[model samples]
Target chain A: MTRAALLLLADGRFPAGGHAHSGGAEAAVRAGLITDAASLEEFCRGRLHTSGLVAASLAAAAALGVDPGDLDAAADARTPSPALRAAARRLGRQLLRAARATWPCAGLDLLARRFPKGAHQPVVLGAVAQAAGLEPLDAAYCAAYESVGGPATATVRLLGLDPFDATGVLARLAPATDRVADRAVRAAREALDTGVDALPAASAPLLEISAEVHAARTGRLFAT
Target chain B: MHLHHPHDGHGHGAPAPSGAAARRPDGTRRALRLGLGGPVGSGKTATVAALCRELRSELSLAVVTNDIYTREDAEFLLREAVLPPERITAVETGACPHTAIRDDISANLEAVEDLEDAVGPLDLVLLESGGDNLTATFSRGLVDAQIFVIDVAGGDDIPRKGGPGVTTADLLVVNKTDLAPYVGSDLDRMAADAKAQRGHLPVVFQSLREEAGVDRVAAWVRERLAAWRA
Candidate 1:
């Protein structure tokens, strides 16, 4: 229940293997969907409402003690791209390794045993939050923020965009991120009674489709 | 990957415990993980290739390459057919090769573990970091030991300047000794600088063009494996 664990999990330097991924920003940049700070904003906004909302809701549900298996299936159902699904599970496996080491809870260990290959990333994220004694709102915030934050950081590297400007984009989206987190928490609350059907299932086709293209791409910097 | 398999065997055994655990989660002694790092054009990949060619016949080995953008390093090893394709893998660094090797090492860690799980009881795993700077060194958490490679043409001054890679790596390799004659790089001075900085740490001057170019490095690896097994 310590507040500091949230910061540890959210830190970009957490060593959870997030640095190698671009959150679909590379595909967007190569597709010319993001050339500067402005287009980057549009991309993030779209992601925050779509896939971002879905991931946050899933995480929030897991943190509220929803069954990880159900949340994982829900996550897969919401994601269209196989490449994105694989990446999510890969990230989930890595995060579980780190979370088990950091939080050392029975639930985290149980999740690892169940999904040896991996569960979905947001499902793992929520379970990790539960293991750390974090609330659903905190898990929702982490998922919502990372949904946009990963892309913002990657764009800084991809476009050589001004670092401050890229950060400014995150700052501008703070209000929107909060709204998404709040909505995600509400959805998670509904999910508690109605099963995973109550969780958000929003999808961003561009992100999913681009992730496939990105996975097939050679000579690309980021993994996805 | 046996997706339909029951709960326990879904992937490889648990990740090899991080740091220097002698045994994997599956309860077998793990390979000796080694890291190779240096500046671009310093022959890091060539050295890895050379080592693979020299050792493949006698040992069970694998390689994990960290590349900045492309899978060029992994592809190069594949094109060479050094080890079976399954024995080698690549971890993309997102343009920060050093971070994958040194700062945040989870990706590289997983690559090695996966390689071991797939084609294992491996005696050695050489992790070749993407070309980086003199300051770069593999995190101890990532690899058990590290070799820092610098060529004569990259400046004999590198060892004297003495960053962590030069001073602290388990082995300091001054590669391209044959090029020293033509590059006007003083090999003796480089050796002296390396000795001064490294003290008792081993340094091997290698010219991959030579007949037994990789022998000494291979011997160093053998010795490490012996010690690791001991």
Candidate 2:
């Protein structure tokens, strides 16, 4: 697997429709759950263990050549909020466009044809990773890091928080991110034998509930 | 498998792999896309509304609005009844309108494509950018042509400053000309500075409050459309 491909996929400027989303951070900020770098760190940590781990495991599984159709269903089963599901598919559809343009592969084309509206983003990310000749660990790392990165960047914009403070928060979370990716890939590998049921189902109830509220908001900075 | 296929040139004569110039699977050309970008309250929405009123009788048209936060721009167009509600789509820019129109255009592209799919055979699609700074401009990949609107009330110095939007736009519009005298702006200086900054590019001085609102801009659109079809 090429390391540069991983960098390209992980770049924040990949142009996959991620800028409009805050990954539930906008809702958290509006609710005063994240006010400064320290609270932002706490929010990201909670997310890394729950949503981040789940997304990473799914992406790793997809990268390992697990059927994206089945994994998409598993993702749906795990996410309870309809708003979150829509956002995931919306972003997934955008990623599919960028990935198709960047790395044309028959599998990616087939998936695009099957889910024109989109599958979950992690499912598409994993497929994109496979198409880019990246390892399952690369996909896992991409998903895990993005899970926190989106919120960190959004916080800097929303609160006028110091950009360095946000970067520092991400730097501090690097070790945890690595551990999560390791766990995610292990779970993905196990799923190859025991089926996708072996993947993590860690849930963050507040994130899901807040996502619904954020969706219902008439005027919001982020699309959730 | 071949990993890297060369992307087709978009918005020019070459067939696009996707976005504005991308043909349907049936190999038919999509609509011409024009972008309107400028500073806040530069009469962009008013121009779009006037253009819709002026041209809707002869051609199929749709609009995609990039708003920083609220759907105010789209709402205003809707309230004006310029076109049916279905023809207007709004894209949230995450407080970065320039990024949505230029750096990463996925959302705006999606909005445009969906508009065509839903209300199709369109002759034109106007993308109205959210109010932003003078540096903001549309990506060539996103629009066939772009118009930068700067009202006389904003300041005649805007043309002298000559940022990317003012200098490089396909057409520069000095709007709210009727308010020029009230605001103490010299139209000739604004015009000369615009000429100096833009060289051969066209600039239109317009006032939507006038009887011939949007005629000059509509004529420009017609010329572009004719050239595109040719």
Candidate 3:
């Protein structure tokens, strides 16, 4: 596997339909939870530790050859908001389309047959990592980065925040993201023997609640 | 690393394109995808509404609109009763109108695929980009052919300005021709500039106020459909 494929998958412009949804940043912005660079940084920090860690763990587990079906179920259980669940599945399906076209493999084909509609995005991300021949840590890193990176980018668009400030937010979170990735890999490794329950299931209640609220609002920019 | 992907031949329900504009997974012929892009208030939505009214009887059609607010144009079509609610969908572009149609088209692709899945055997699917600058154009992967709409009122000099949309679109439509005199836009100069920019490519001058304003565009679409079937 070309290790550089990780960069391709993790790139914000990878075209997996992430541009439309703001990773809950739109809701946060609308609710006045993220008013400036400092608030955005704090929001990113919270997400990196919670949802980021959980998503990274699931992706790492999937990359480590865990059953995607079980991981998908675990993801469903972890995501409390119906809106979030729908967004996750929609993103998963979109990613699968790009993945199957980008990296055609028997495994991805089976995934398409299994969840013709979709699975959770992290489950698909792990599957994509496996198809790309990336290591579990790489999958963890990809998911961990996406968790904060998406929100940071979206906050920039939503608030018209300085692009450099947003990039700085991602830069500040990188070290923490690395730690999250490492912890996720550890959890995924533990899950290999102990089962997926051993994986991180950290929750961010506000993100979930705001997501449900965002989905209900008709006049909005982001999907969730 | 080798990125040579072999056709495993299991593309059932695959959303991306292959044998493009050719056939669906069920072995039925797919609809021709046409794109309409232009600047703000340049009559992109009006043209779409007119196209729907003119062609809906003879052709089965659907629309996918990309916009910052996301639903206004789609809602406009719905309010006008251009097509059933199910046939029209909106894609959020996060205010980057061009990205949805050009840079990363996955969302738009899925929108069209979903439309086809829900109400299918469509003769055409028109993907309308949110109003943007002249640089915005549809990715070939997203649409079979594209029409770039400019209006006499926006600027008579837009064709001479000649960006990608003006030069490369399969069809360049200079809309609001009736407003030319009112807006001080020279019709002859605009036509000449369009001809110089597009050469052999087609351009249509339209005014929705006319008795059969959309007929020319409708005829062009029908010709494209016949050619696609051929």
Instruction: Return the top candidate by lDDT.
Output: 2
Give all candidates' CA lDDT scores: 0.88, 0.90, 0.88
- TM-score result, candidate 2: 0.96
Better model by lDDT: candidate 1 vs candidate 2: 2
Q: What is the DockQ of each candidate?
A: 0.56, 0.50, 0.56
TM-score of each: 0.96, 0.96, 0.95
Q: State the lDDT of candidate 2 residue by residue for A139-181, as single tens digits.
A: 9999999999999999999999999999999999999999999
* Residue range A67-108, candidate 1, lDDT tens digits: 999999999899999999999998988888778777876677
For each predicted model, how many residue pairs clash, with residues at least 3 apart or on different chains? 0, 0, 0
- Residue lDDT tens for model 3, B89-187: 998887688998998887888888788889997889999999999999998878888989999999899999999999999889889898999999999
- Model 2 residue A93 CA deviation (Å) reads 1.0
lDDT of 2 at B186: 98
Q: Which stretches in model 3 have alpha-carbon errors above 4 Å? A: B1-21
The CA lDDT at B143 in model 2 is 87
Q: Which stretches of candidate 1 lie over 4 Å from their true place?
A: B1-19
